[model samples]
Target: MDLANSGLSGEAVYKSTCIACHGGDGKGAFPGTPDFTKSKGPLSKNDAELLSNMINGFQSPGSPMAMPPRGGNVSLTDADLKAVLGYMRTTFEK
Candidate 1:
């Protein structure tokens, strides 16, 4: 998917890019991935911190793999990241 257009909604971006690992339920499909449904999971962090982590990439403490910069999609803009972050919070945060 060419995200260069910047018109995709957060849910769309998530279904296309994030769902592979984060899973549709936000429980994580991969080993060591954080559980977004947890009350104190990764979503507990403030937006700025979350954005920084998403922008620069992040590796959970025990995760065997790290999320590449921009979730490996260089075409995603800061807006897209924010949108997806909001989506995750609304849909998954407990």
Candidate 2:
């Protein structure tokens, strides 16, 4: 996807890389994936914590699988992660 030069918007990144599990509406598609609409859900975490998890990968308490580093797209930069994070917060947080 040439992410190195694409400068993709957060929504684009989310659609291309995050939608499969996170879903179009931010509701998780998997058995234990987090629901972004909930006030106390994963979005409640601060950016630093969320970024760290995204960079290093994280498995929620009951999630069936761990989110791979950079949502499985290792080419994504810190800026991209932050952008996607912001997008999620804006688009899904209640």
The TM-scores of all predictions, comma-separated, are: 0.91, 0.91
What is the per-residue lDDT of model 2 for residues 10-59, given as tens digits with 9 covering 90 to 100? 89889999999999999898789889889999999998999899999999
lDDT of 1 by residue, 1-94 (tens): 2335456678987898999999999999988988999998999999999989999999999999999998999998888988888789889987
Model 2, position 19: C-alpha lDDT score: 93
Model 2, position 36, has a per-residue lDDT of: 89
Clashes of each: 0, 0
Residue pairs that clash (backbone atoms under 3 angstroms), model 1: none
